[model samples]
Target: MSFFTRKKQQNSSDASLVLASLGGDRDAFCIIVARYQSLLCSVAYSSVGDVKHSEDIAQETFVEAWKKLETLQDPEKLKSWLCGILRFKVSRYRRKAASQPIEGAEDITEGEDHEAGQIGLEESAIREQEQALLWQTLEQIPANYREPLVLFYREHHSVAHVASALDLSEEVVKQRLSRGRKLLEKAMVTFVEDTLAKSAPSLAFTTSVIAAINLASPPVQAATLGAGAAKAGSLLKWTGLVTLLAAFSGVISAFFGVRAGLAQSRTQRERRSVIVLTSLFFIFAIIFVAGMFGFKHLAAQHIVSPTLLAVISQLWVLGFVFSYLWLTMYLLQKTRNLRAQERIFNPDAFTHPADSPSAKQREFKSNASLFGVPLFHFRFGTPEKNDGPVVGWVAGGDRAYGLLFAWGGIAVAPISVGIVAVGGLSIGAVGIGVLGIGTVGIGFVGFGAAALGYKAYASMSAMGWESAFSGGFSIAKDAAIGSYAFAQQVNNEQAADIVQLALFGQGYLWLLGTIAALVIVPAAWHSREVRRRMKR
Candidate 1:
C-alpha cells in the first residue's frame, strides 16, 4: 500500500482505539498501548540512553495521551504524536539528570548492558538472518541519523511524518536519511570485509546473510537520492565554526575599544566610563556567546522564546548608536575648545580691536556684524554669543534619556515575557514584580545623581560668574551690558558642558548594560574566565 493509504488506515484504527478508550474500554486502551509500546520505548531509549528511564518516559507518554485523548486531531498520526511527547519527556529527564550526582558503578554498567541489549537481536539461523544483518547495520549509524532512518523505514513513515515526529524540517529529515544510508552502507561493507577475513569457516554464511539482508531492505539510497544531502553535516559544522569566530571577534573589538576610550578620559570621568563600558561590553558578549551556542537558531526555530532575542538585538543597536553619537559630540567639542584656547593665548592673531589697526577695525567690525555679532559688541561677547555649546548639551541629554529608556525597556520586557511564556503566569508574575522594583530603584538612583550633579554645576557657575564680574575693570554702560551678556554666555557654555558630561555618563551606562545583557550573561562562566586570562 502507498504511504498515504497506510497512514489513513492507521489513523482509522487509532480513532477507534481513542473512541473505545474514552468510552471506558480498558482493553481498547491496552490494545492501543500495546500497539505503540515498543516504538515509544525505543524513542525514549534513544533520547535518554537508559532503558529503565525510557520505560518511565514511555509510561508517561501513554498517561499523557490517555488524559488528552479528546484533543487528538488525527488518529493515524497518534504514534508520531506519542513519540514526540516521549522525546520531550526524555530531554527533560536528561536535563534534570545532568544536575544530579553521577550514577553508581553498578547502575552505570547495567544501563550500558541494557542499551546494548535493546538493539541486539538473535534471530533463528534459517528464518531471518538477513533482516538481522540489516538491523545491525542500522544500529551502527549515529543516533541523530539513526532515529530518522528507523522512523522512516521501520515505522514506514513519510518524510513529512518523520520531520514532525523529530521536530525537524522535511528537508532535514531527507538529508539525515540520505547521510545515514551512506554511513550504513560503509559500515556494512566494513562488516562484510571483516567477516570474510575471519578465520572461522562460518564467515561465508555471514556474508550471505549480509547480501540477502541488503536485498530485502527497503530502497532508500541516502547518498545519491537527495540534493546537498552528503554535505549537510559539513555545512552545519563549518557554519557553526564561522559564527563562533565572528561573535568572538565582535566581542573582543568592543571590549578593547571601550577600554581605550575610557582610559583617555579625565580622572573624574573614569569611574562612570569604566562602569558603563564594562556593563555594555559584557552584555554584547553574552549575546555573541549565545549566538555561538546556536541559541539564535534555536530561538528562531521556536525551540526557545523569541522575545529574548529581539530585546537583546534592539538594546545593542540603541546602545551602540548612542555611544557613537556621544563620542562624536565629545570630539567635536574638544576640537572647538582647543581652537578657542589657542585664540585666547594668541590674542594678537585674533581680529580684535586691540589686535587690529584703527583703519582695519571698521572692516573687521562690518564682517563681525554680518556674521550676527552686533557692530559695537565687545570681543568677549563672541564667547557668550555662540549657541553650539547649548545645542550640543541639549542633544546629548536627549540621547542619554533615549538610550536609557531603550536599554531599560529591552532588558525589562523580554525577561518579563520570557519568564511568563516559558514558566506560566505565576512564575512570570514574580519576574515582572522583580523587574518593576528594579525599574523604580533605577529611576530613583538616576534622579538622585542628576540632582547632585546639577547642584554642583550651579555652585561652580555662581562662583565663576562672581569672580569674572568682580575682577573686571570699569567700562561704559553699553560695554557693561555686554560684559554681563558675556557672563550669561559663559554660564550657558558651562551648562552645556554639564549636560554633555551627564549624557556621556548615561550613554556609557547604556552601552555597558547592552554588553551585559547581550554578551556576558550568556557566555559560559568558564569562557569568561578564559577571556579574563587572555586579557591579562
Candidate 2:
C-alpha cells in the first residue's frame, strides 16, 4: 500500500500507531511523526518562542519517545506522554544552553539545510524579523493565554485539536482563546495566527526524522534511500555556506564603498573626523551584533525575557540607521560650509554689483557688539543669500546660531528653543543635544512624548540604550521602569538614582554648577555691556 493509504489505516488511533510501531513497523512510526509534528512544535514554541529551537526540541522528543516506547504504560495517552518527553527535553536544552556562552553556540548550519531553500535570503531575513516582533508581542501576554493562542493557530485553527493536544476541555480552550486574542490585540491576533499557521513543520521534517531512525538501525529497504538523502543533505550544507558567503560579500562591498566616499571628502579635517566616526560606527555595530547574540543566548537560557531582547534589537537597528544617516548628512553639511567659507575668503572671485539689493542685504550688524558678533541678531525672512547668517550672543529667527541662547525655526546654541533645536539644553518640537525636552527628543538625556537616548523619560514610546522610564512602552538595555517595560532590570525602583546619575554624574553637581557659571557669568557680563552701551 502507498504511504497515504497506510497513514489512513493507522490514523484511527494513537494506540494502534504505538502498537504497530512497537511491532517493528517503520511506516506506522512515519505516520506518527506526521501526525503530531505541528502539535509538538507548537507546544515547544510556547516554551522556547523560537521556530528552529522549537522544531529541534520536537524532533528530539520524538526520537526519545521512540527509544523509550516500552516505558509508556498507556498507549491511549500517547499525546500526553510525548508532551511529557518534550517538557524534559526543553528543560535540558535550557540548562545546556545556559551553561554555554553565546560564542560557543554558533553552530548555524547543522540540519537547517532543509529550510535554507524555502525562501530567498532577504525575504527570509525580513520574515524572521517580523516573526521576532510577533513573538515579542506574544511574550507580553501571560503564558496560559499565549500557549492556547499559539496552539490554536498551529493546530489548523481548530479548537478541538488544540483542546485534545493540550488535554484541556473544549470550552476552556474557547475561553482562553478569547482572552488571549484580547490580550494580543485585534491587529496582532490576526498576524500571530497567520504566522503560526504558515510556520508549521513541512513534510520534509517527517521524512528527515524517519530517515534518521532508519540510518541508526540500517534498515534493508530504506538504507539506500537514507544514504542518498544523507548525500543530498551534505550538498545542501555546502550550498547554504555559499549563500552565507554571498551575503557576507555584500556587507564587505558596502564597507569599501563607505571608505571610498570618506576618501573623497573636501578637507583633511572633515575626512579624518568622518573616518574616525565611521570606524567608531563599525566598532559599535560589531558590539551591537555581539550584544544581540548575547541577548539571544539569554533568551535561550531563560535568563531574560525574549520580548526584552527583541525590543532592544529593534530599537538598536533604528538608532543605528538614524545615526548613520545623521553622520552622512553632517559630512555633507560640513563640505557645504567649507565651500561657503572659501567664497567668503575670496570675495573678489564672487563679487556682485554694488547697486544690487542681494549684496546690500547680505550683511547685517547690531551696534551693541561683542567679539564682532552682535549681542542680539535676528534674521526674519525667507532662506536666501540676502537673509544672511544669524550669529550673535543671543540670536533669533530662522537658522540662528548663538553664543549663549538661540531661538528660531532651526536654532543651535548653549541653550536653544525652536521648531528643531540643538544645544546643551534644547527644547523644541524636535530637540537633539546633551539634554533634550520636546515632542520628539533624542539626546544623551531626553524627555518627551516620544524619546530615544542613553537615558530617556517619556509619556509614550521611550527607548534607551542604557535606561528608559515611561508610562507607555519603555525599552532599555539596562534599566526600564514603566507600565510596559523591556529590560534586564525592570521596575527596580532606581528611577531617582538613574536620573541623578544622568544629570549630575556621580554627585559632581558642584562641577556642573561651575560649568554652568562659566556660560552664565559670561552671558551676564555681555548683556550688561550691551545695555550700558545702548544707554550711552
Candidate 3:
C-alpha cells in the first residue's frame, strides 16, 4: 500500500481533523497535513525565498507538530503555531548561510548586461541567471534585514501581517525592508526587475510536503561519551601484557605445576589416560588472553572497526611525534633567539660582508619588501667565525628558501616550500611525514593510513604493503599485494607501526625508539666485552 493511501479517512473540516489528530487518529493527522501543507509551504517560502528549501521547512514543521500534537492549546491556532516554528528554522538557516555566502564578490562579473539585445528564449535564461545571482546575494545580507525583505516581497504580505508573523512592530519591519534593499543595491548584483510577483501553491507541492513530513526524524536526546574518554590511554596495559605473555611462554612456568600426587609425569593407567597438564594450559590461555586484550587496547588499529569507533584508540603517534616536534621546534627557536646575543653584529642585507666580523660570507642572495620583513634571502656563512666549511645558509622572509650543509639549515616565512620547511605545510618527498591524500591511496613501503613506498614502510603495519611494507596491519606484507584482495579493510586497518631501527641508520617515525634501543643495547654489549677483556 502507498503512504498516500488513506484506507478509512474521509473528507474532514480543519477543526474535526485537529481534534481527531489530537486524539491519536493517524488518518486524521494525514488529513490535517493534506489541508495545511500548501499554506505551511507558502509561509516557509516567504521566509526563506527558495521553493525547495521552503518545502523542506514545511515538512519538518509538520513532523514536529505531529510529535507535539497533544500540546496544541487550540485547534484554530494550528497554522499560527506552525508559522512560529518555521520562523525559528528560517532564522537558523540564515545564520549558517551568512558565514559563507553563495559566492564572493570577486567571482561574479562586475557589470554584465544580459538584457541589452537579448529577447524571447535567450532573454528568459539570462533573466533567470540574473535573478539567481540576486537571490544568492540576498542570502548574503544580514538575517535581521533578510527576514522582512523576503517575507514582504515574496508573500505579498502587508507590513501589519509580516510584523504579526515575526512578532515585530510594523515600523521595525518597514525599516528592515528599506535597509535590506539598500544593501542589495550596493552589492553589485542585478535585480531581476520583477514587481514582487506572488503565485498560488499547487496540489503537487502540498502532497510532497506531507510526504517529507512523514519521513522526518523523531525527537530524541543525543548521547555522549564522557566515561570512555576518562578511561582511555594507560601505559600499564602494554607492560603488563609483555610480562604476562613472557611468563606463559617461558620454560620455568610449567615445571612449578603439580602433576596430581607425585608432581611427576603420569604412569600406568594415569600415563595411558593423560598428560594431566590441561589445567595448566587452560590457566595459561586465560592469562594470555587477558594480557593480549590490554596490549591491543594501546594499539591504534585494534580499534577502528566498521562501527563508529575513533580512527585512533590513543593519540600515541601524535604524542610521540609531538615530542620530536617539540625538540626540533625548540632547536629552531633557540637558533633564532641567540642570533641577537652577539656583541659583534652579523652582516645583514644592507651591510657589506667584508665590513663585518671574520665570518666568511661565501655567497649571498637578498630581496627587500615594503614592510620590515624581507621578501627573499639567501646567505652562506661560517657560524661563530669558525673556519669549518662555511656551511650555513639562511634564506627566507615574506618568501624565502634556505639550505645549510653540515649544521643543517632552515627555510621559513609565509608559503614556505622545499626539502625542509618549517612555517608552511611541506609537500616534498623523503620524510613521508604525517597524513596525506584525503581518502584512498597506496604507496609501497608507506606507513600511514595510505601507501606506495620504495623503502619498506614500517610502523605498526600499514593498510597495505609487500616485502617493502611494514606495519601492524599489512597483509602478505612484502610477499604480494593480491594475497588479501578481498580483505583490504582488515589489512589496511591493521596498518603497521614503525619500530625504531634499521640495518643501516634509521629513519621513519619509529626511529626514536630505534635510536634508544641501538644506543642502550650497544653500550651494554660493549661493557660486557670490555669487562671480559680485563678478566682474561
| Per-residue lDDT of model 3, residues 1-536, tens digit only | 11222332345344434533432234456666766655566566556665556766777777887766545555556667777787788788767667656542232222223323345556655654755665677667786786676556545558786686567899998898888778886635234224234333456665665565446532111111122111001111221232333233222222221121121111233222223333433343344334333333333232433111112312333333343334334533433333323323432321543324342332233455434433333332212222222111334221234342111222332222222233322221112223221011123333322233332222222233333232122234333111111122211112111211122221322533332332233223323332332221
Q: Could you tell me which 10 consecutive residues in candidate 2 have the lowest summed lDDT?
A: 219-228
lDDT of each residue in 1-536, candidate 1, tens digit only: 12342243244456444433432233345556656665676576556544355566777777766655545555556777787787788878877777663653456556556645666433223213443465466567789987776556534447886676667999999999889778867647555334312211132332332333223321111111122112111211222232333345345434543443333222333435445645654554354334423533443245654345433432432343344335434533543454355456655444544322232221112233323433321111111112222111101110111111111111222222111111111011011222121100111111100001111111000112121110111011111110011222121223223222223322434533443343333223213332332221
TM-score of 2: 0.39
Better of 1 and 2 by lDDT: 2
Task: Write candidate 2's Cα lDDT for 220-274 as tens digits.
Answer: 1111111111111121122223223323432443354244334333345545655
Error of 2 at 44 (Å): 0.5
Cα distance off (Å), candidate 1, residue 485: 99
- Estimate the TM-score for candidate 1: 0.25
Misplaced by over 4 Å in model 1 are 1-11, 50-52, 67-77, 104-106, 109-144, 152-175, 188-536
**Shift of residue 372 alpha carbon in model 3, Å:** 99
* lDDT of prediction 2: 0.60
Candidate with more favorable, higher TM-score: 1 or 3: 3
Q: How much lDDT does each candidate structure score?
A: 0.36, 0.60, 0.38
For every model shown, what is its TM-score relative to the native structure? 0.25, 0.39, 0.27
Model 1 gets an lDDT of: 0.36
